[model samples]
Target: MEKVRVLIVDDSILVQQILTQMLDADPLIEVVGVAGDPYEARELIKKLHPDVLTLDVEMPKMNGISFLKNLMRLHPMPVVMISTLTERGADITLQALELGAIDFVTKPKVDLSNTLDKYEFEICRKVKQAARVKRESLAEQYQRFAHNQTQKPAVESFPTTKVMPKLSADAVIKKIAVPSKFPKTQQKVIAIGASTGGTEAIKEILMRLPENTPPIVISQHIPAAFSEPFAKRMDTITPMKVIHAQARQKLETGHVYIAPGNRHLIVEREGTQYFATLNDGPEVNRHKPSVDVMFRSVAQACGPNAVGILLTGMGADGAQGLLEMQQVGAHTIAQDKLSSVVWGMPGEAVNLGAADQIIALDKIPRTLLEVLTLLN
Candidate 1:
């Protein structure tokens, strides 16, 4: 197979060189060209027709955000934003994603060598994934919507306030056919993994858990700076104690520990207590805080005492690990397709028979509650 072609666009020569080296180190990726600014990148794009572009947030001639807007309007393609690891950078990167950039990576200012080594795995993985992404041009999206409208059969208008009947607690509870069977007599831990549309999905699930819910270890694929604020925000709204995982922190019931964006969080058991283990190991499934690594650890440490949840994400990052959980007799649940923003991860798990229960997004919390109750 042909390697995924990539073009690097950055104002800093050092950044361009570092990123190019990191990407080229991967056998599945090839750096086609490097540009000092958008003007240079425009010329390279025309000449090389690379499959993916890695863009720096700040450039001398034209900023990445403005270039991204024009790119989406005129020639839509997969683009990943590389920004400094700062508050300002995080805001800009989020905006870039809304403007159609596939994803963002944070560049550390100090200790460049160590930081680059820490994030190189995810950066390369994002580039490869971005290459396979099917970008929708503004024109194409408009035309597709128009076609759908034309194809729909005419119907009488219905009342806007005719809300669909909500599922009752019993009805929702009955849908969780699979038993958790977790040994709640002993300490229990919940390990969750998600990516892609995970941000909103995680919030929904975490917010719904009771104040006494078991401690949760979550691995969501996201940038470093973003995870801190994301966890804090979840704490404000949720009944459970939600915060980013810190090294050596003791696992406490009713607290939700989100894995730091660029590091993996593993569970280490000591007698009757458990603690967080943060490491900079090689990326599993091309993610540092990989769901696979976390799940596998939970499988070993907690076994039947754990509840594993694989939420909406792209790719098969957590499938095998979730299967491991099932093999160990741990309860494993995956989010169903209709409620997922992108059904890649959970779909793969369901297809592979790794998931014990597949539940809709809204129903997941209730199902989890039922499972916890049964386990107790």
Candidate 2:
């Protein structure tokens, strides 16, 4: 197999050097070129023909969002954003993803020398994941998005490799035996887990749902700086009140709770009501707000009265937990491959027979609504 060719685009010489060193260290990736600005990047893109681009959110001459917009419109390709751990950076990075960037990695806020190994592992893994995306599918998705359609594209199957061994959901919560019978319940809760293409996908689902939907809880793999901003953005667009999950926050209907970055969001039942509980446990499946932890908690708390959906993402983080939900008699759904940006998570769940139904992206909202009606 050919190595994934990458182009590093950043104004800072230090960032350029760091990115180059990290990507080149991966035996499956090669740093083909480096550019200081969009202009230099354009020239290098034509000359080097890199498979993926590591773009900086803020650049010297022209900003990364503008360049990304133009690039996706004219020359569609896979792009991974390098962003700072600031609110402004998070907003801009979200915009880049809206414009067609595959994923993003945050710049280190602490000493780079001390965090180089972890940072390198993240960036390199993202770059390789971006490289695996099909260009034609990206172009199709971009055109539809340009026309305000909800249809997303599919990614070609690629090996989901891990740079370092990762901990499973068991690190945070132990698995318990699933009960053969579950008591009927009138109240229902919705649990969602996503990564990579999730921000846009989540927005699509939320924007289509009515304001009277059940209480929704989400665990999207994101950084600490971006979660609140993301929830704010969703609240503005969706009919539901979207809030960043607070410790021991009460879960209410017509509201969506998003897990804070670096904290596991779990569901617990008190009397007849549910609440969002936050955990500061170590990373599970190499993610702080692990979907596995969230799903497992939902399985335990809601049992037959929960709906679990795993959307597009680049790893098998939530597969087992989704299965656990199924075993507990919860209705579970996985995004179909045709509309997924990356099929790793959902596909894995399907393989495990965890999904009660496999649905397309555009149809998920209606399907969920129908299922909720049947449950009631």
Candidate 3:
């Protein structure tokens, strides 16, 4: 098999050397070239045509975000951001992902030795995953990129009133029905699993829920340092209490538990009560905090009392587990393609007959509420 070619773009020679050493240790990856800044990266891109690029957020000639915008417009490719672990870095990294970078790794604030020791394995894995992403053409990406860039400035300058799209009652009613075999009891727990476009999607659903919503357990694909802040941001806006799942924390109504990034969160029944179990299990579906792990556990522990929601993501990570839930009499819902950023996960569940109701994004929360009411 051919090796995955990579280009390292960082101003620091020490970082370039360390990244080259770490990535070269992996037999499947090949370090094709290195660049000190975006100008150098442009030259390397023309010459080497690497499968992946490891980029630094801050560089002398041009900042990473500006470079990223141009790169996506002119020559879109899989780029993994190397960012510092600061609030500003987190905000920029999130923006980078939204702008089309495959993923990001938090740079160590301390010495090289400490950073490498902590992040070597993670960095290597992200490089491999980044290599697999399919990028859009310069023209196609640029059209959207330019539109987004101009839209914000235009909106701020003109201050035109924009209408919010509302979901019709008929559209909402179509997705509110419970499955024929849905258990006639309160669905006290909801287990949600999503990857890729989950951040914004989950926020939309959570913000729409009432303050008295049932307990929700989420397994969203995210890196280690990002989950805590993501949960905190959600908690501030939503009435529900959102936090990263901790081992042995009891599952309570109105509380939302997000699986700690890189750790699996499973549900266990202790007689009449349910609690979370955080474990360092082997990666399932190429993800540590995999949806499959959480959904399967919910199927076994909660059985008919659970509701499984599979959301927008890029892979079939939650398909099998959704099936298990359906087989065990749990009502399952998958996000419809029209509203999904990537329809892979939910599409797979629908194909496998796991989803009882396939709903549009805007209708999901309300549908969930109606289902819960009927079941109750």
- The TM-score of candidate 1 is 0.61
Task: Output the lDDT of residue 55, model 1.
Answer: 94
TM-score for each candidate, following the candidate numbering: 0.61, 0.91, 0.66
RMSD of each: 10.8, 6.4, 9.8
The residue-by-residue lDDT of candidate 2 on 117-142, one tens digit each, is: 57888888888889888887678667
- Assess candidate 2 and give its lDDT: 0.88
Ranking by TM-score: 2, 3, 1
Please provide, for model 3 over 1-376, each residue's C-alpha lDDT reduced to its tens digit, 9 standing for 90 to 100: 7888999999999999999999999899999999999999999999999999999998998999999988887788888899987767776776676567766788876797656657887788778866655565223434544664566311111112321132221221121223345334353789998886677678768877866787899999887777777788778757779988887798888899998887988887766678888877666777768888888888877777889999988778889889888888778999997766568899999999999999987688877877776655
Global CA lDDT computed for model 3: 0.79
Predicted model with the maximum lDDT: 2
Candidate 1 Cα misplacement greater than 4 A, ranges:
1-82, 91-102, 107-186
Model 3 compared with the native: what TM-score? 0.66
lDDT of 1 by residue, 1-376 (tens): 8899999999878777888889999999999999999999999999999999999988888988889877876788888888888877876776566466767778887877667767788899888877766665323433432443367422212122322132221221111223344333457888889987576577668766777778899999987888887787678757788978888888998899999988888887776688888877666676777888888778877778888899978878888778878888889999987766567888988988989899987677877766665655
How much is 135 displaced in model 1, in angstroms? 9.8
Per-prediction backbone clash count: 0, 0, 0
At residue 357, give the lDDT of candidate 1.
96
C-alpha lDDT of all candidate models, in order: 0.77, 0.88, 0.79
**1 or 2, which is superior by TM-score?**
2
- The lowest-lDDT stretch of 10 consecutive residues in candidate 3 is 155-164
